[model samples]
Target: MMAISVTQHAHLLASRALGWLHTHRERGALPPGCTAELAEPDTVYKPLGETGLAASLVLREAVAGSTELRLARELLDFGWKQLGGGSMLHERLLRYPMMSDPLETYAHYARCGYRHEPLELLLRHTTSLHSTRAAEVLPNRRLAVANAARISGFDRGEDGDEGPRTGSTGGTDWAGLTAATWLGALPEPWLIDWLTAYSMTHTVFHITDWGRLPERLPDDIVRHVGRWLPVWIDIWAEIGEWDLVAELLIVDNCLPEPLGDAAVWERLAGIQHEDGLMPRDGHPVTGDDQERFAAHHHSTVVAAVAGTLAVSRTLGTR
Candidate 1:
């Protein structure tokens, strides 16, 4: 293998990671006749959405090279098709109007120019209902809905500069919803367990629209994250929790002024398989095709997101 600077390491990491996702896109497929009414959406639907989320961010940042870009678009297509071309989302909303996953999943595709008119209309109407707001959900899930809603024209954006990304009007206060999240509180640092760490990273992800708008983050929140995120990154990296490490790395690049830790980036690149898989931990990744995909697909998506943001932020700074 050729030598690489840390920035180049990030570039290659992104392309390779996304390449793996495109090749294994089928691994995330739902079973035949799957529907929104299914009891466990996580087994397949959630993975598809997460994959789309990574691919959409790659397109949105316009940071990936031509190969990565093509793969990203293909990944989006696969996700949309897997959802029965948005019919699943519409049916999902019909089944459980209060559910946010469909809207959240649809927004990932919409931001990248994938559209489903029926889903959009229903999302607009359903999200506006008083019950949607009244739905008892975790605060971070609420933030996810707010971000997705804004992206899909169901609500206005955080900047308030533009109306909805589409034609819809009136929505949640992005600022208020964010404040309700765990990270928004900036509570005692020692209180952050592994789960809270994931929550904090996601809060960063949703608030910044996966790093497209770092300016949307408040100064206090930024400072709070900046002050403590390094410690968390170091702790996770030490434990071989490569999945969480990659997420914290993405959070780093999302900051108004990123740490741009070259050592960590290089370390991540070194550990990634030649085919672009990033193991979830230091253990050898093993399984049948399906088991491996199920076990560590998330870490790989996170690695892709991390590397993509790292490159984009560096170029943006320059």
Candidate 2:
């Protein structure tokens, strides 16, 4: 197995990671007593949202076999059901129209043609507001919302500072917002911290439309990411920060010319459990299934995305 091609390794890793997610899909369900009031991003929505994002990316890449594709589609269905077929997002928007998570999460489902007309209607109006455009989120987060708005067909334009703000988004100022993100400035690589590294990765992800358009990243930004990304991945991977490492790898995959580093994928593959669950860090998972799910769910999604995108980059080019 060690001698197998890197592309094969990525596919296997993706298949198993998704298998783990499907087996534990219910672990991602809203807690029995959980209500909208009690639900935080991590508690209910983030897990499924990330899962849907992974599923949607896998489907978009079109590199998976029938079984893997089936799992991805099924996972999308489960995520939508968990969100009440978009009602939960609709209600959340009603409560906090400025909050971007609902619309961002909704975009994952929307990518694959999942729609709740009422939710769409609500999203259309809420996202169009100038207030929503200037919602003061972290810049990368603004990109997330902008990309989501674009997906939902509510974006006025992917504009930037080339044209003045006019104090109205007229849609999203993608270029100006990109300039606002941590990655956009192409900051000194040494300045990044753990959390900011994530902000940077997500900036690239949203700008590239989550690997659909690697060329969307500016040439300088792409060169900066391509140069430093390996070091970042190694830094985290060395400390057993498997989740962060996987995300950084996804950033690599989003490059116009992904490294598709065979050694890295092999090392990552070794981290997967026999059942497909990838641990979040060097620490052993030492809790009940729900505890394990909570601890490692996001990494599992990241691993699935990383592997799927890796395969797409490696094999698609062949």
After superposition on all C-alphas, the RMSD of every candidate to the true structure, in Å, is 2.7, 3.3
lDDT of 2 at 133: 76
Cα-based TM-score, every candidate = 0.93, 0.92
Query: Which lDDT tens digits does candidate 2 get at residues 168-214?
Result: 34645567889998888889998889999989989988888778778
Candidate models: Cα lDDT each: 0.84, 0.82
Point out where model 1 deviates above 4 Å. Answer: 1-4, 164-171
**Which of the numbered candidates is closest to the native, going by highest lDDT?**
1
Q: Distance from true position, residue 171, model 1, in Å?
A: 4.4
Steric clash pairs (candidate 1): none
- Candidate 2 accuracy as TM-score: 0.92
lDDT of 1 by residue, 76-176 (tens): 99889988889998898888988888899999989888888888778767876777876898888788887787677677543564564343345468778
Highest TM-score scorer: 1
